[model samples]
Target: MLQQETRDMDGHYEFVTVSDEATIAFRRYGTPGKPRLLLIHSLALDGSIWTDVISGLQGQAEILCIDCRGHGWSSRAPLSYAIERYADDAAEVLDKVGWDQVVVAGCSMGGCIAQAFAVRYPKRVSAMILIDTTAWYGEKAPQEWRARAQKARAEGLASMAAFQATRWFGDRFRAENPRKIQEMMEIFVRNDLDAYEATCIMLGDADLRSALSGFHFPVSVIVGEEDYATPIESARQLAKAIPGASLTILPGARHLTPIECSDVIAEAIAKMIEAAAH
Candidate 1:
């Protein structure tokens, strides 16, 4: 049986497990009868990042916040990392829970997984909420930045944390939320280098642009007002490409908009779910 634990963060806890030998740690909130919403964490940080969002959505929706493989309590995979593997793992977890369909809300890396999941298992998804993520690089990234992925895999987490944090947050957010930013940075900075590198490689190589064109579901793109990584322009392009997709911009936020602007995200999600239900 899967072990359950508790924490005081709006009545959540650290629940970790190695399902089929894969490290799977996540938190569950709200009544089971509500529509299930799977919350996928960003790269580096664990599932705990969704605490604020989950707390607000509790009772309104059933929340399953997950830590992807090679992050949080989930153990590493034997082979190389790819976005598809994360999607497969997510599908398996949902299978275990007996959910036929769910609303997948993802951030950054998790957003990538959400795209792949909808492509691979269309029937399993009711809708998708992609926050600060893109299907693929709009233009080719710098060679050195691309090559750094391998270095991170070889050198480990300590060296790559700073670069990761810089890309994920803006200067304003760094100044305003120093302590919270530091805590999140540690999650990435202190991660196991190999796992982090593998995930980075996965993000670098995976392309979901083509996949989004043919996807037949409701997709809501949430962009941070000042997100440098996946800026408002990128989010607009994604929304435009996906037929009937909606877009929202969260003010005073960066790449971590779901966490930084949980109230707004929750409102967007609630509206999307309601629209779909009607």
Candidate 2:
């Protein structure tokens, strides 16, 4: 719970009003002059999802962990919620923070936003990592996503926690990380219903397959081998669509690679940084 403008460890938390008049919350870590990395979280989750991942990244890179407009400390009731809008928000945050270009990393819903960001503001992204996300949710996406949103609308976000847990982590991880699972559930249950519904619908209607092929920046697709929400097949499709994109599959991990495979992710970003320097 970082308050806006509360400086600590040479980093601070801040907020920026986006196109829709919604305040998006973000926290900066590490020295200002260091290389930057933008971390976006998944559906029903916030930037805190990157807590473990950030520790490995902090010393080497200046990291901006964002709580997307609809989740975490950001404004829950927004004028609209869409992947493109989220992407635009990222650009605004970058401008405010003076990060000209960065390595963008996102998981699940955040990955969609990252893809949208690269498309709309390509020059701002030097490299990107898409984890546990898809370009499109198949032909039945609209109906399927609508159903999920409707369930949350009717039963509430907490009701989906069990289902989300299974999709987010393999049985092994769930057994191994009881505390982490509980922490994530706490975040999921705090979400505003209206905003969560809108986000689900936005994901339902999102289609970025055509836009992905045009991406010229370095891209990497990482996914848990057991991820069901956005499975390995989806990751494979993303790798195939983006020119020269690399794909990494982690065994026994699920959708939340930021938590379950943070070290691997940090290594991948380090590689991205090394590659981008050349």
Task: Point to the candidate with the largest TM-score.
Answer: 2
Models 1 onward score TM values of 0.87, 0.94
What 10-residue stretch in candidate 2 is worst by lDDT?
2-11
Model 1, stretches more than 4 Å misplaced?
1-21, 139-145, 150-156, 159-163
lDDT of 1 by residue, 1-278 (tens): 95443333454444444345565656677676777888898877888777778777755777777778888777765644667778887887776667778888999878889999998998888888999988875546434336776676677767766776677776776777788777887787667767766776677777788877776788899988888888899899888988889898887777887767878888887776665565
Q: lDDT by residue for model 2 over 1-278, one digit each (tens)?
A: 95333224444568998767889889887655566889999999888888777777756777899999889888887457878889989999999877789999989999999999999998888899998898998889989999998998888888889988888888988998999999999998888888888998999999999998888888999999888899899999999999999999999888899899888888888788767766
lDDT per prediction? 0.77, 0.87
Q: At residue 128, what lDDT does model 1 achieve?
A: 88
Best by lDDT: 2
Candidate 2 TM-score over all chains jointly: 0.94
Model 2 / residue 181 / CA error / Å: 0.7
For each of the candidates, give the backbone clash count.
6, 0
